[model samples]
Target: MFELTRYDGRRRVRGSIALSVGLSALAAMVIWVYPSFEAEVDLDQLLAAYPDPILQVMGVQTMTSLGGFLSFELYTFGWVIMLGLYLAYSTAGTIADDVDRGRMDVLLSMPLSRRRLVAERFAAMAVPIVGANLLPPVVVFIGARLIDHPLAATDVLAVHLLSIPYLFACAGIGLLASVVFDRAAIAQRVALGVTFALFLSESLLTGTDAETVGSIAPMRYYDPNAVLLEGHYDLVGAGMLVAMTLAFLVASQLWFGRTDIH
Candidate 1:
């Protein structure tokens, strides 16, 4: 029963480590450069130069402090956008790639049910998602200490902890795509496009009459800036994201169960 989950998870370990290390390195760089950057430029004036909509989209609340700066420069783009897109793209290929390469037939011929196979494959996504979220905070904390920045450990922890469900929700989008499309490339492309479009819609439509439409986007729930800068943790939003992920997973399982492997 757990064999498929363990095998798929092990397959992802190396890539997950690489992703974790790369993000950690980026976080270190961002933390290392903070002091000099703050001294040289007027962050307020800089933030003021951008339009309000642009600032809102970027999650750039304040850049004067390390937490705010990291929230804006690092977490917003690196965590929210890049990591979300990467997971979506990676998971998007999970089922479709096997199906496209005729591997699904072999797997289906085994004792595994279609629903169980889809569930296990999707569960394997936890490897990368957990890796991506785990290592960066350690690096950021050490970097903050070395640089003499008074970053709160609780805030750092909160931001990463809150991001788990959000990342899973993004992966859920890809899981649905992986089951919906027969070709790996098509599933991956569609998943990536849809994820990015959701992000854009959430960013652009906020506070407008159509803002409720963006509620469906996972980005609308996770706010790294709020967690880091303001120490605000939206437990309800995280719960919603968890619910959304389950919804996607169940939908994928149902669709894959009905899909003809041929």
Candidate 2:
């Protein structure tokens, strides 16, 4: 099952790997360094230098230093939203792509269970995800080194540690879509739209009285400010993320198991 599925997966894997690299680079620049430089300029002071209403609209006062970047600021929200988009883009069509290209039957005809086949294909998708999640910290590490700043290895790792489960959850969501939606384009659309909606719900919940909506968006639980800056992790939130990933993975397996690939 693994061999057959991946034989088809290997077809699309290279391009996705390239995309992961691109995502990592873009994330490092937009999410990591943009805030780093914005911090150096004392964006907080500048915001404070302005009036409350103005800063409220511009959304700069929340940041005081490189550390302040972790707050639910625009860039942080942007990063979460953008990464979700990438996750959807990368994982959504992975399985359905093969099927739409008329290859699901070719692979399933071999001595393999559809469940086992989808599982391996799902694992194959993670290689690029790991690369995407890990790459930013490496750049941040190098930047921290160059500036003689503190880069608590644990904290740096904590950010990625906090992030990867969400990635898998998204991947699982995509795979679930793959099994349910016959058209690759439709599957990709469902995953990307749903993930982005989650991102927006979480962001809005960060400021407004929308905690209820937040319960629906997993990213709301991450609290990058506390984890990335305060160096405190919400074990419960992280645990839930893990649980969600497992749930989605199992759901994917079950859905695929019952699916008629023909």
Best by TM-score: 1
Q: Model 1, 187-206: lDDT tens per residue?
A: 99999999999999999999
lDDT of 1: 0.92
Model 2: per-residue Cα lDDT over 1-262, one tens digit each: 3674456457656765675566556545544555457656866566667775444332333564454553444235434556656666667776788778888888777787776777787777666566565556666556555655556777767776677777777677777777778779999999988887776666555566765876766676565666656789777887787787777767877887887766
- Candidate 1 off by > 4 Å: none
Model 2 backbone overlap count: 0
Quick one: best lDDT, which candidate?
Answer: 1
Steric clash pairs (candidate 1): none
In candidate 1, how many Å is residue 225 off? 1.1
Quantify all predictions' global Cα lDDT against the true fold: 0.92, 0.66
Minimal lDDT window, size 10, model 1: 224-233
